[model samples]
Target: MNKLFRCCGALALGLALAAGGALGAPTPAGFVRAQGTQFTLDGKPYRYVGANYWYGGLLATQGPAGKARLATELDFLKQHGVANLRVMVGAEGLSNGYQYRVLQPLQPTQGQFDERIMAGLDYLLAELGKRQMKAVLHFTNTWEWSGGLGQYLEWNGYTGQPLPKNPGYSWDKYRAYIAQFYTCTPCQDAVATYIRYVLARTNSLTHKKYVNDPAIMAWEIINEPRPMLPAATPAFEAWMKQTAALVKSIDPNHLLTTGSEGDIATDNDMAVYERLHADPHIDYLTIHIWPKNWGWFRDTATAKGFPAVLARTTAYVNKHAAEAQKLGKPLVVEEFGLPRDGQTFTPAATTALRDQYCGALFGMAKGNTPASRVIAGYNFWAFGGAARPVPGQVFWKPGDAYMGDPGGEEQGLNSVFDADQSTWAVIDQYSKTIR
Candidate 1:
């Protein structure tokens, strides 16, 4: 009887290998795969502390100086054990029109693309590949900082000028206008065309198709996609589903995420959050917690507000993690940030509060509890790298160095610069613990 049982086990193992090597699917080596609330790379568990490097691709677009900085920053991140990056694939529209938009957008016109920007993205991917680093490349954004969803609407002739935070537009008006993207047929079509174009691209430097590149861990639909209203919820969910299906059809090798801010983006409805991410095509779930933005942390002093801040953050992540578990997918808190000491916008200012907050959050992922197991990975808000904000510069200008903070926000706000040794110490410590 013992001999028969051993023979049966051997046969089952052989069959599993022949089919897909225990994953029950044919996933190529070096690709990240989500399997039952965990991330696997080359059939081994993969997790890491990472950063939000939104300007990485654009940096390569600049001349030699830019490429040099890009290389140096990548090296710095790798040395600190940050093998994963969340980056913008490209921005949209002409930079001259918007006061707060990324320079060198990939889609400058309606359907036309800027080849130079595309090449920059290619270069960024090649460099990441050489370092064995992974990137989650989001194709578009809901915010005006990137000329993203609003840009598509403008191109489709839905609006004369997109709702950027100009003098006349209010936050409520901007939200209402951008929300039209979900129901706009032409706007949706234009986005699909852009998506198809990008997916079909062959990396100029690496001679690899975007769909076939192992450096890319996943393709995010959009950054912080929100429905804005209950009436738009159906359209938003449909758009997400259709986009996921489209990307999967084009490139089934890489993973897909909604780039959602969990229930926050879903109109503060946890059920809506779960339902949207429950789509079969979405490989994993994602949530972004902003204590400052959410009004959970307000006091300038860390000791005054950190306890409440930490408590709220823990509860928010735990809530989404429970939902992720129910849906059988890993959860990544891809964007979380706190300001510098006293919320200052200078690199020289201390980041003691930010450091402590980051350490506690990283601990949540590395802990042995149920929430930790479900929370497979995370990326801090922004990696400012070597870029220092110009003195007295509140927002980004054309000649100013691009930091982790986007143009829409204060340049140094929540940026983790290369000189931040204390922050790096916390990040490196937890990064080592992850793997």
Candidate 2:
């Protein structure tokens, strides 16, 4: 609704429940870095196919019910060769937003932190470390879920303003208003404080400070951060550069990324993307292909049979890869997905189209393109494992199963379910080839 949103064997080969307690991550003892349009892990090429498990930390609860589900999901992913995870560490106090946030009120009041969610993250990192997996942890968001821009505005005393579709305003107008976060003094300080808090805190379970933890591959400034209006470009760029510098100044161990949805920059040129990423602090580049939202294809909710959509997607990935290559930074198509064949959310829906599209993208990551290996990897739009939203439910309610989806994304529209063996088979086949 808002945007397009590691390793081992042996212990990794065990059954889901029996694979518990697999020691700390077996990754090389250093962080990842950009090595000429490719990532290097301990001086070796780090080519991998990762999954977007934004709800991972939240799912690692001490409670029995959630813990079992979390175990099952992680084991399933590991069994199929998933090693890199992209997770959401962003959460704001509950807001009046329509889609009730899953993990909310992390900051009950401005500048105050929530210990509960912090422990949840601690447990998550501990588990990932045990499995020898790597993670990309994103901090903030441009959208509503996880208490992003709206919460920031409300916290800074700019309350009650209409957002996008509210009464009379447009999305760009609302985006310009949210753009206030780049320059607002109080908001900026609040974020810096949040960053410092997380970077310095030691994981309660792992007992390792976040800055020194190799379990994390990178720190994303925000999810899908962008300059909404033309005039907001300079300010956004300044913010991006300053934020990257600040993160590096604090944590020199992990890689950094802007989480920008590479596009024709507000300067009306794609070169702006390359220029902004030119900052030495940015270790890599990312792009999100929203075939449904971007109109490259039709969603099943309305129509069907857009076979040519995959062709358009291929071109987009290549174009962005060429741009990333020019900057000499690794590029990740970290977000892309197609709806199921008929766009059905029912558990019985077939993912034939989705599987074929994934195969093509995975092929590109594994050097099946004109440029031959310009893209390192890709994470599909989302993965909804072992979860089913309440029958006929529209908006996700509290305590509904964690489905690897953000609010407002139509239920099951893009989720790769545990039951989708065809999709998993495609993923497993690519797992050995993507590097």
Top-TM-score candidate index: 1
RMSD of 2: 7.9
Candidates in order have lDDT scores of 0.87, 0.75
Which residue ranges in model 2 land beyond 4 Å of their true spot?
1-30, 161-169, 264-268, 299-305, 368-371
Q: What is the lDDT of residue 80 in candidate 1?
A: 97
lDDT of 1 by residue, 1-435 (tens): 146643753464455345665455577778998867778787566777899999899888889999999999999999999989999988888866677888778888889999999999999999999999999999999888888888888877767444456767776777788889999998899899999999999999999988889999999999998998788888988998999999999999999999999898766898888887899999999999888877785556656888888888888888998998899888998999999988889988999889998999889876456687678799999999999998987988888888999887888988999999999999989999877
Q: Which ten contiguous residues of candidate 2 have the minimum total lDDT?
A: 1-10
> Which runs of model 1 end up more than 4 angstroms from their true locations?
1-25, 160-165, 299-303
Cα lDDT tens digits, model 2, 1-435, are: 012112322123232213322553433466776556667676456778888888887776647777788778778888888888888885876656555565555576678988888888888777778787888998888876677766777789976545433467676667767877777778877877888888888999778989989889999998888787766778878888888899999998788988877774353368668767788999888888777777665546423445567677778777878888787777887887877778767768788878888898887764234344457667776878898766787556766777766765667778888899999999999987775
What clash pairs does model 1 have? none
TM-score of 1: 0.94
Q: Best candidate per lDDT, number? A: 1
